[model samples]
Structure formats: C-alpha cells, structure tokens
Target chain A: MSIRYPNGKKFEKKRIFSGQKNVNNKDDRFSNRGMSLEEDINETNDYYRAHQIAVIHKKPTPLQIVKVNYPKRSAAVVTEAYFKKPSTTDYNGVFQGKYIDFEAKETRNKTSFPLKNFHEHQIQHMKEVMQHNGIAFALLKFSLLDEVYLLEAHELMSFYDKQDTNRKSIPKKEIEERGHLIPFGYHPRIDYLKIIDKMIDRC
Target chain B: MSIRYPNGKKFEKKRIFSGQKNVNNKDDRFSNRGMSLEEDINETNDYYRAHQIAVIHKKPTPLQIVKVNYPKRSAAVVTEAYFKKPSTTDYNGVFQGKYIDFEAKETRNKTSFPLKNFHEHQIQHMKEVMQHNGIAFALLKFSLLDEVYLLEAHELMSFYDKQDTNRKSIPKKEIEERGHLIPFGYHPRIDYLKIIDKMIDRC
Candidate 1:
C-alpha cells in the first residue's frame, strides 16, 4: 500500500515493514519481532554507556516551563509549559574522547530522503559542531527497507547549501553511495558504534 | 529576613540591598546568577564537548508522559506527565575518555552540608557510577556564601553509609579540607574545569 505525508510526498508502506519482522519467526509485525529504530538505538546507547564504549544520549527538546503546581505530598506538576528553541543537534555525547553530535530521523520513502526533514537551525548547529571539530552526523532510517545509514555532517551540509537548486531530497542511491550503512543485529541492535569506529578511523 | 521551604528548611536572605537598583544594574539572586551551577557546568561541558574536553549534561528528571496534544500548527504539548524512577545521577557526561557523573545541590547551612539533601536513588546511582569506573561527584553550593565545592562520590558514599550513627551532615571544615574548591571566574563563571583538571590529575 502507498502512504503519503501531508506535504504530498509519496511513501511505500512496504518499505517500512520489510526486515522489521523477527528473523526467527514468520510474523514480522508481531510483538516478538522487534522494537522501533529509536528504541533499538536507545538500547544500543544504554549498552554503550554501561560498557563505557561510548557516551551518547538523545537530547530532550528544550521547554519553557511556565507554571508548576506543588501538591501537598506529591511531586511538582508542570501545569503550563512551552517549547523553546533548541540551540544544538538532537543528540550529542562523547565517543572515545571525541565529541559526537547528530540527529536521527526515520522515513518510509523508497526513493529518497527529503531535505525538508531537517530544519535550518539543525543545519546551523551541525555547522557549529563541525567548526568545533565535533563529529556530527545523521542516523537516517529507511523504515520500509528496515535499513539505517549514518550520513556525515559534512555531506549533509553540502546538500543543505546547494538544496535551493538541487533536488529537495537525497536519493536512496546517493545515500547508499555516500553514507555508512548500519547493520542490524541481536545485541546492540543498531550497532552504531561500529560506524562510529569507522568514522573515528577516518578522522 | 528568612524564607521557608515546604520541607521546612529555613533560608536566610543573605544579601542586603543598600539603595534602589538602577535600570541597568540588577541584583544577583540565587536563581539569576546566569544559570545554576548545573547550567554553568553543562556549558563548561559543552565547551569541553566542542573542544573534546568533556561530555556532560544535567539529566532530565525522568517523566512518564501520559498525554500529548498536537495542535493544528504547533509543536506537541505534553499535557499529562509524572516523574519516573531515575536510574542515574542528575548530570553525567564523558571527560578525557572517562565517564563523568554528578548530582548538584544547594544549601544554606553555613556550618555543615546536610546528608538529607541527596536522595537514596541518587546515592545508588553514584555507587553504580563508581562500579563502572566513572568519576562521580557532587557540586554543592552554599548559595549564601557563593561557595561551590566538588565533593567526590566516594566521600559522599562513605558519609551516606555512616548515616545511622554519624552526624547527619558533613561539616563545612571537612568539605573545605577534603573537597576541591571551585573558584568562580569569568567566561565560564563557575569555572569547574579547573577543579576537573585537579580531579583528573589526582586520578
């Protein structure tokens, strides 16, 4: 079946479900199959943090807390709050003494990942990260194909700078050609650190 | 004058204003010192992070988000949320390839810093940090005196373990002698990297 976003971008639902099912069973969408990419990455990060392999976490969205209610004998309840502008990338941490920063996004697109997926602030943050010698990248999940790719910030910046005239999206063929493919596994399902190791080596 | 918290902790107003404040000159309150110690440390960590010096940030209080509202043209608003069990310290990041973890607290007591200021779960988290070869500490601020100290997790653990019979607080003299004094300065106001440097040297 086909699924299209509000922005008129077409997506194939088949790509979103491909290898998502458990390899040990026939039911891919069953409860036993697996968790989402975000969950897998969170779990992998937890493992990495525990083992001291690397320290990384998803940065919480900045919020402007306005009103808080303190009950008689309970925790404070935030009655009113608002979203604040995020000054940096969505995720950042240290890896093997190197600064790591990135954003994670998943799409069901079988053809390309749209440039509109990223914001101008995120691009600016990436540029800042690069200026400070930080390793910045994006974890792009082609959910339909159940594949993930780590595209370096430098490449993303290049695309962003030329996005005005070039294609509004990064083609899957180009992603395969330029980005590091992250293989899924049982333990540390995303195994992003392996790609991180490669990135470190390149650096 | 004195201020009382719901917990019945009495806080004495330390600074006495002599004259009416000018438009440009503002009084520095405990909250307005341009980000709490937690924030200054986080900024230092960011600086460290960008410079590959350290990775650290204040851990968000774990909240079980129960309800979210998606407005037609706005960001998602969390309407209902509850605090969840936090598994780690308030702040943690990587430094010089070492996992750095810490909790921060402010006290008004001029004689001693109370043991009750820290939660049991926080103590447990510190223990876990130690088990993982992480450098853990607490940044204690005597707000009235504008003094901050970096007390190691081991010392805190030792104090906590002896809470049954020993004094309920660690005397300021003890902290002065044992804990590293973090001198306040410009740029990174509460320049904690200097303390971290000393701690790193000790390690």
Candidate 2:
C-alpha cells in the first residue's frame, strides 16, 4: 500500500496542535496567538459557519482501501489502505451567491514557493473552475516569515504553464507583487474573505 | 475502532461494478445502460466535465486514521482506520456559476423513502447552503420502482422537522406531488440538471 501523495510527500493525518490559539474565545475577535496555516483556515471556516458568513470546508484526503475486516457484532475495521491523488483542490464553498474554490499550502523556504507543491490535476482543476466563472485561488503561507498571500489561479498558472522558461518554483518576490497579503485576526485567524470582498468590489 | 457511521450503518468501501455503464461513449450520449444511482451520477459528472458543462464531484469518504507505518525505501501504509461521519452532503460543485450541493440515496422500499438515511448534520448543511443562495437537493432512487426524484432540501426538512406530526417516511404519493421527477436518459443516465434549468427558467 502506497501512502504517498502525488507530490511524493508522505501522508500523515494532520496532527498539529497550538496551545495558544484558543478556538473558543468569542471575546477576542482579532487576536492571533499563532497556528499552522491549515489550522488557521479551519478555525476561520468554523467561525464563518457559526456566524453564517459563508460555507467552506476542507475535503477529506482521498484513500484507496485494499482490505477490511467486517467482524460480526462489531464495527468494520480498515485493515489496509493507500493514499490516492486528489483530482481537485482542498477547499470549496459559496459566498454571496458565487462559487469559491481554492487550495492552501505552506513552505518553510525563505526565497521561493515550489511549484511542485501543486500537482497537475490541481492546476487543471483550478483552470476549469475559472472557465466556469468560479472564484479560484491558492492560499500560500511562507511559514518561516509568517507571511500568507492569496494568489489567483491565473497568476499561478502563468508561472506553471511557462515551466519551460520559468523556475521550478514561484519566487517570493513575484508572489509578493502578484498576490494579496492575507491579514491575520483574533476570531477568524486568517481573514481571507476580506480580500475576496475587495476583489469583488474592485471588479 | 467504530466503523459504524453516525447513522448506525456499517461502513464499507464502495465496491460496486457495472458491466454495462459504458462511461467512455461519446457518440452514444443518453444511453441508459443501467447502473447504481451513485455510479450514474458519477458518470454524469464525468460527462459534464468532459463537455465543459459543469464541475461537480462526489467528495471522498471521511475516515479517522489511527495508525500508519513508514517502511524504509517505500511508501507509508495505513494499518488502522475507522470511518468518520461526514459533515456535508456527498456531492457538490459549480454549474452555470451556481453552487450546487446534493446527496444521492437509493432505497428498496416501493411505497416510501425513509428519513433515517439522512443525518442531522447533512440537513443542517443543506439549510446553510440554501441560506447562502446555493442550490441544495437530494437525488432519491426508489430501486424497486426505478423512480427517482429531486427533492429540494426545504421539502425534506419540512417532514424532518415535523417528526412528531408526520410519518417517519415520506409517502411515494407525497414525493410524486412535491418532488421533481428525475428523468433517466442515454447520455447522462440521470438528467437532474435539466430540472434545474427549468427551475431557473420558471423563476
């Protein structure tokens, strides 16, 4: 059983914990105690749901089960399973009657965000989302610098599609220029929808 | 590990195979070579994607992985896992810039559709979807009668919320009166989108 992602990264069930990022704090709406990027986004989504802001969720990791034990008088147990490559991005939902789709990734590299973090199908799926007039983007976090940016699908594609000439990764400088810096806050740790609101208003 | 889902149903990996549903037939669009409701919807989704008509997909089953092994010079293998209850419906995507969400269920009952097949979270999720102006529905298949209907989320909730006053299951006559009959055809075996088109037109 191959529990490797298409990007060749080992699949570990998300196991991050932040002792400081108190999710139950309703009093503090703009304080960021710090958390992993995925944790921040998940917290933000829960906030969104609680406040009826929008409906977004992270899709579960795809898996291929090869064997199972259906013992009598008890619950079934998965004996052997393998991770499978996902055909679409991680997060999707609706806000203001528009369909939103995006993928989130983080890197410790200080200079560039590697294109290899994204798989071929993810990019292709984003393109298809855009073709259908859905809002598509990538939430990139430069963990070493504590910087996060919302880059539209087209901008990422521009770098990816010109791979013959471009570097294997997107330079931090280019991301800073083309992407919108996502601000952190107290309640919804990563306030991404604010950027979306601006994008819609500007358009 | 409890592999029994919240609905108390035994969880097993999808293991259905149909010898007749020719998914690759481009020339013979609309041929209803019989298939399971889930299979028909999946094939329809694939066809819609190939034609650039829509971008719907069934979400992967959620699982609670407990243990994984990382062997040297090879891939990781998930050795122990349990099925986790899902928070949302099975299928969702963007179609004509509209956010569409739905669950497909099949029952052998000829006279009624049981409400137990649905969970509280799914109903709550659909309500949230509708609140945000997204499309929400259920693709119900009465296997014994080969009758399928697209029942909007609100309608399902009406009976669900009035559990004390109403029968546990929705009568077939009530469904026929209230739900939109989903027509099966050659290309996309179940043509629910056509009903959506009519819904938009009438509105």
Candidate 3:
C-alpha cells in the first residue's frame, strides 16, 4: 500500500489537522479515529455506493506523463509525469435521478475559509454545472470547529468574485448563515445527501 | 508532444484500421480525416461543451506510482508507475440534469464485436450506474464498416452474461437491430445524444 518516489522517498499522505485543542475525543459511530476530511468523505461515498443510494466518486488525480518504460513480458512503467490541476470538481454522480456534483475541502483556519484554496477553473466548472441545471455545491469542513457545511455553488461563486475587491476569505459567520449544516451519521459519516435533499425540496 | 518509452522506443498511438477495403473516400462534414474514433468522440464532447449541451469528460488513465523525484524550483516528477484498471466507466458527467456514464470502444472485426474488448469490472460498473438510475450505455464503433451504435447497458450486460455459456461475440446483426444508429453531424460528429433522446422518450 505504500508508494515510493523516484528519489527513494516514500509518498506522504498529506493530512490537514485541525487547529482546535478541545475537540471531542470520543469516537462516535460515524467517526473513524484519526481520519482526514478526504478519507471521511471517501468512506461516506463507499457507504452510499454499497447501499445503492448514489454512485458518486472522486475523480482520479490527473497526471501528465511524459515518459514511460515498457519492459518485455511486464507491465508498463511511467518514468516521468507531473500532476495536473483538475478541470472539474472532485465528486460527481447520480442521486434520485438528478445530476450531483460537488467539491470537498477542509480548512484549519477558525475565523474564515481561504478562497485561494479553489482554482478559477474549478469555480468556472461549478458555474457551468449550475447553468446546466445540475446540483452544484461545496462541502466545506471547518476542521478546527468540527463542523461541515454544504454551501451552494452560487454562494461560493459570489464570494469568490468579491475576493477581487473585498475580503479574500469567506468569514465563518457567512458560511454558518448561508450554508446547510451536514450532520454526521453512522454508516454514511458525512451525510451530504441529506443536505442535498433539502436543496432539492427547495427547488 | 511525443512521448518515449523506457526501452528507447517512441510511443505509438494504437489505431484499429478498418477491415473493409471499400469504405467511402469523400470528406463528409461529420468526418475528420485520419482521426480515430476516440479523437472524434473527444471532438464531439468538446462540441457539446461549447453549445452548453453537456459537460462530459473522459477520466484520465489511472496510474499507480511507486517512485517520484522532487527537485527544488521544479514540479515533482513521477519515476515509477504502473497502470491500473479503472473501477468505473471512462466518460462520465452531467448531461441535461441527468447523470450520464458510458464507455466508448472501437473494433476492427467486421462480423461481431469481440467481448474480450470489455472487462468484467467495467460490466459491473455499468450495472452499478444503472442501479443508481443513471444513463449507462456503450458506444460501439465498427471501424471498418464506418458505423456507430448506441447500445444500452442492459443489452450489453445480457450479451456479456451470455458469453459464459453462449457465443463470445455479439453478432453485428444483433447489435444493429437492438442498438440505435447514431447519425454523424458536422459539428458534433457522433450525435449519440439523439439516441439518448429517443431512449428518454420511450421512458
């Protein structure tokens, strides 16, 4: 399961730890101890898939490979490649006969979530998703606060635009007021579909 | 850009040449001279995107890297990686508020498409997509015959299942009769969405 780099260095799984000191220590049914936000979302996706509730999946990281080595009677080996920025959001799939797409990110900052975390291409992609009548949103996890919120793409886009003239980050209060709080659950740790249900109801 | 393999050999694009010798020579608006089926489909997807029709994209080839070299003032380079079989279909995205997922393959056989072109994991993935109420199908292109068909996942799954005891190939006659013929157009070369529209109408 462990991967090594060309330089003989092992690949490190980047973990964004929370800044809070007094977070709950008890592991809830939904909690997997020491799991990162990305790991939690992946587990939730698997849960949804196993139950036949949805078919969402995180797109594989894009890579631009320049050179490869094909040994006779063996698998091809990539010798040179660089990571590429994704053109769309992380997660997308079908739920209740609807097109669902969203990006999930975690921030350790307690006061505000930095807008710089998202790229312009990703923002443009969400806008396109919304224009096509597909449900688009962001799963913003305030790791320090132990809180997750589902913010609509429109809200995120608006804040992103304001960064050019106004504040560069989305204040915690704005997110709390505008975003739908997603309650963690046992089987599906981050029950995002629950928030999606409400959004669908409103529509 | 050209790529080189580890054995000092240049990577060549695998093309399935047509089996028939009497194919048409006239340049049709739908036809992009010397382009492979994959290239044409990519162009069609781009056409769809420009027209606000859909946002489908082919997932990048999955690679499991074991080595990389990170140097200062440059992006990290992957030194050793192996290809992995994808767990889902190639092209997937939202189309007209519906979740769309599909696999596209080109064949050189004049009689029937060899079932060996598809893998069991792919069949299972399509079944999962169907279970989630997503639109799942296969774009089968007979390169020699210069014909393309939009075959439903159910049709493919049934034929795939029969391969265990029945014929290993799906006869061309069976495919033509059961699958919808996708008309080629100037802008969006393979207009498979027309077939999807008919399918939706039937539903």
Candidate 3 chain A, which ten residues in sequence have the lowest lDDT sum? A20-29
Query: Under CAPRI classification, how is model 2 graded?
Result: acceptable
Model 3 residue B26 CA deviation (Å) reads 23
- Give the alpha-carbon lDDT of every model: 0.67, 0.79, 0.78
Candidate maximizing lDDT: 2
Fnat measured on candidate 1: 0.07
Candidate 3 clashing pairs?
A4-B66, A5-B67, A5-B68, A6-B67, A6-B68, A69-B6
Off by over 4 Å in 1: A1-34, A49-52, A94-99, A130-134, A198-203, B1-62, B71-76, B89-102, B119-136, B152-168, B197-203
lDDT value for model 3: 0.78
Over the stretch B24-91, how does candidate 3's per-residue lDDT look in tens digits? 11221222345556677888989988999988888877777677677999977788887887888888
Evaluated against the true chain A, what TM-score does chain A of model 1 have?
A: 0.80
TM-score of 1: 0.71
Model 2, position A197: C-alpha lDDT score? 81
Give the CAPRI class of candidate 1.
incorrect
Residues A1-203 of candidate 2 have per-residue lDDT tens digits of 86874662232212111112211224222213446677889999999989998999988877787777868998678888877888999899988778889998876677988787888999999999999988999998876578899999999999999876457888999999999998778898889998898887887
Q: Score the docking of each candidate (DockQ).
A: 0.19, 0.48, 0.48
